[model samples]
Target: MIKNEKIKATEVQLTGLNGEDLGIMSTRDALALAKQHKVDLICMSLMTSPPPCKLMGAGAAKQEKQQEKKKAAKTPDKRKVKEIRLNLQMEDHDRETKQSQAERILTKGDSVKLVIQVHGAKEGTAGKEWAEQLCKSLAEYGSKTTGIQVSGKQVVVQLDPIE
Candidate 1:
């Protein structure tokens, strides 16, 4: 958007600040007309024959563009990966609560990760097996994205929704 004396074109199709066409004119005259309206002479299309130039406030044009960008960010994507944490010694009721929460998350077409952390010295096969059983019960909602895996003190399971 070269302006005024900075425009290399000898002549251009000129449009007034109020969007009225002033026809094709020399760059010098276009600058004079733009100055009369207290706006900048902007070269809009440099590639066209007799490039089109318009008289507009650069700040206003930039501000409008920024506002358009902001509007695009307001939309939301519902797909997400949610986590449900469990402990090796969690009570049965607490496990039921987490299962219900996972159901809700999957109902929204999202995925869930079930994590179980063993706290006591008995950080062995028992904790991982329990966590696997919980994950398997959720098969009514969807299939497991991965096989249950066990670390030294934690177990992780991933499930994706049917959709």
Candidate 2:
């Protein structure tokens, strides 16, 4: 936006800092008025007849409008598969707490992958069983999104939030 001599329009529709109209006047006169108001004369829309202008300063409302525009452009996180690992030795309460955490993640429209990692000789079979049990318990919050799979000592189960 141009101020004073920089403005091409001979006359402009002036709006005060408080959003009050200051009537149509020459760009120079509008600039003088803005000077009196201790603000900058900014031409808002210049293509139309008698271009519209505003009195702006450090407290210009345009700043807030720009801030709001920036805020509106933000987007929510895109859906991604989240992982929640479990221990074969976890107590019942610990297992329930982890399942609750998975529920919270599912509620946000993200898939949850439950992994039971064990370090013992029976961990392969035992981990898969534990993973299956966790998926069954999570039925109220979500549905199994993927089949449980066992790889080495780890068993994985994925669940999606109910639509």
Candidate 3:
């Protein structure tokens, strides 16, 4: 914000200390008025034809900026959830690769949802066991947030990164 002696515009749209419009006036007169009130003549915006300037205390402006910074710092960023699907009859090598992928995701502070699906008539009984074992193997990287859920031919569980 351009202030006082630095304001190049001969005339400015001035706003008073109490937010009242003082109309378009010479910058010298506005500076004098600001001096009279022991405040600052800060250019609020430079985009207009006759830039709008306000009379504000320098300390007040700094305090407002600090308050905004504090508000921003208080808000937390949201984490993303990654989904990985597994087959009930996955081979040992493939299972190990999937486990490593899940660990990588968890290390990055993201949640992982594991979905295990079984096909055919006789594979339903072992799906839950397979899912539970996979979850247990990944326990070091993340903790289970949801219990194993069995619905039809699928078993699902969610793991959240360890803080």
Stretches of candidate 1 off by over 4 Å are 1-78, 119-122
Off by over 4 Å in 3: 1-76, 120-122
Would you list the rank order by lDDT, best first? 3, 2, 1
| Ranked candidates, highest TM-score first | 3, 1, 2
Worst 10 residues of 3 by lDDT: 118-127
Task: Find the number of clashing residue pairs for candidate 2.
Answer: 0
Candidate with top TM-score is 3
Compose the digit string of candidate 1's lDDT tens values, residues 80-106.
Answer: 889888886778899899899998888
Model 2: worst 10 consecutive residues (lDDT sum): 58-67
Comparing 1 with 3 on TM-score, the higher-scoring candidate is 3
Error of 1 at 142 (Å): 2.1
- Report clash pairs, candidate 1: none
Best by lDDT: 3
Regions of model 2 farther than 4 Å from truth: 1-78
Model 2 per-residue lDDT tens digits across residues 1-163: 4655678888999998888988898888888887897888887776798999888884564686688778877856557899998988889899889988998998888999988887765787888787778778878888987788887778888898887
- Candidate 1 lDDT trough over 10 residues, lowest sum: 119-128
